[model samples]
Target: MTDKRIIKSSKVLVTGGAGFIGSNLVDRLLEQGNQVVCLDNFATGKRENLDLALQNKNFTLVEGDIRNYEDCVRAVKGCDYVLHQAALGSVPRSIKDPITSTDVNIGGFVKMLFAAKEEGVKRFVYAASSSTYGDSTNMPKVEDIIGNPLSPYAITKYANEVYAQNFTDTYGIETIGLRYFNVFGRRQDPNGAYAAVIPKFVMQLMAHESPIINGDGTFSRDFTYIENVIQANQLAAIVSYDNIKELQVGSKSVFNVAYGERTDLNQLFNILKKNLSEFDYKISDVNVIYGENRAGDIPHSLANIDKGKNILGYNPEYCIQRGLEEACKWYWENL
Candidate 1:
């Protein structure tokens, strides 16, 4: 991270600000003395995520949908930077309802990008996904290397990168995309059909119930912590345009935002159980159940974070073990 955090004392707009990641970013921005506006419709976001932010004088909540251009324009009003975190996430959800996912992830993305351009924001940083790696057999995924998108959710994220680059080329808007790998942390929702594995497993184990693995437990991911993601967003918001153009592949910059390490599902399960068992003795005795692999699931995932470190001065502070310790502690105390 840079000594001079560039986004300080500025007006910033965080789309999907009521969600887990968005709300955390909002709180960080507000704490740094930035006037922050959060845009969310509560479709997947929880209002309680903004409880602390709402109490802060620097925070404003815009109850609106990104699918609506007018709502997008209103949210971008007078903001210097736009962190576009809004999207319909989850592979199974997209597989079941590709149309709605397309409307929200693709259509909503275009509206937010155009709104930033129209508002003349200094920069636009967005939440990209590791799912863009798709069916690639690459050991450590790089920014330029990719394979066919396995799910509609992956396609939408790739489309976001494409549109962001095009906007930079055609409209002269500065954009940066952070391809996040399996981000987990505080405030992540634990109850839902589309809940992420970490939080879902935490809740089940809290109740002394068995947590099920989606496969034979060989699948792996480069589980990144949320604080590292926040660091990447700040760096992307601040890095000079000249520096970005030098690394530009298609008029914009994209980097893999990860901890640069992989953990298998079996290892993840054991860690979670061990961490949560501190709260309840029975949790230590709980066992895991294995089922068929999920649709659109990848066998392994890892990232090469050299691009971010070399260009943006990004040094991730938390590894998987440290991150899981923090996340598990939060779930036990708060949820």
Candidate 2:
């Protein structure tokens, strides 16, 4: 448990602002009386996701790509803080095209880092991935101890962590990295070949279709809520410089943003079915289909969130069930 820190009124840039998680962060920032600018190229980000945010007077959307230095420079201007969430986000997507993943996740990240540093931004907080824990077999992953990356996507994300470690020495900028677990909630895309399990399952179950599990359903994850992730970002932005330094591992200060627990795919299926049943009883009986395990996927992932609690004062408000219930309601009404 940690004491909460309030975000002050400031100009902030959200790199992938038109996407699922980025859009949510934009909305929350606007409500907190902050000036928010969202930068997106619409490559994987959707235009419709910014509908509500576009309506906010405090929100400014920058139509640009992180891959371009000019665009990054343009977006980072006059920003007090940067929330860098832009990247090609899926393991399968990366395996299919490692070049694109490397270009965006690695190259694009360095571009943003320089942009923030050039503009003298107060802090640079970006999303990291739990996939960095690859091949470790650690029950509850800690920040300092990590294993070799399993896939191209994981490799790229871990590379981001490595670069961020040298920011203070290389660029004199404060940086915080959030190693996010399987984050799910409202606005998270439920389509595409790389769609996450929760929303995809919800959408399929709503349509009375059986979900195809990628593995035998034994693979587990820490399935964190979007609100908790949002809080993590908010808290990270305002973290004290000394505290930020204290959380450093090999020069990078990263925290695992998760629910601090685990849920296997089979349990996830049943949980979604149970939650959706309250909305429509008929959907409860929908069966799940099991398939072969994915090539680069790990068997289990859980996080040790003590570092975040002790340092950033993060205390997650929603559990998996509560998040699933809310997500079900949103999908029922919006989908």
Over the stretch 205-225, how does candidate 2's per-residue lDDT look in tens digits?
Answer: 998999999878999999999
Once superposed on the true structure, which residue ranges of model 2 sit more than 4 Å away at CA? 1-4
Candidate 1 lDDT over 1-335, as tens digits, reads: 34455479899999999998999999989988899999999999999999999999888899999999999999999999999999999999999999999999999999999999999999999999999999999889989989999999999999999999999989999999999999999999999999999999999999888989988899999999998999999999998878888764642399899999999989999999999888888899999999989999999999999989988888999999999999999998898
Question: Which residue pairs overlap in candidate 1's backbone?
Answer: none
Model 2, position 261: C-alpha lDDT score: 85
What is the C-alpha local distance difference test score of each model?
0.93, 0.90
User: Candidate 2: what lDDT?
Assistant: 0.90
TM-score of every candidate: 0.98, 0.97
Best by lDDT: 1
Q: lDDT score, residue 302, model 1?
A: 99
Q: Looking at model 2, how many pairs of residues clash?
A: 0
The candidate that wins on TM-score is: 1
C-alpha displacement of 231 in model 1, angstroms?
A: 0.5
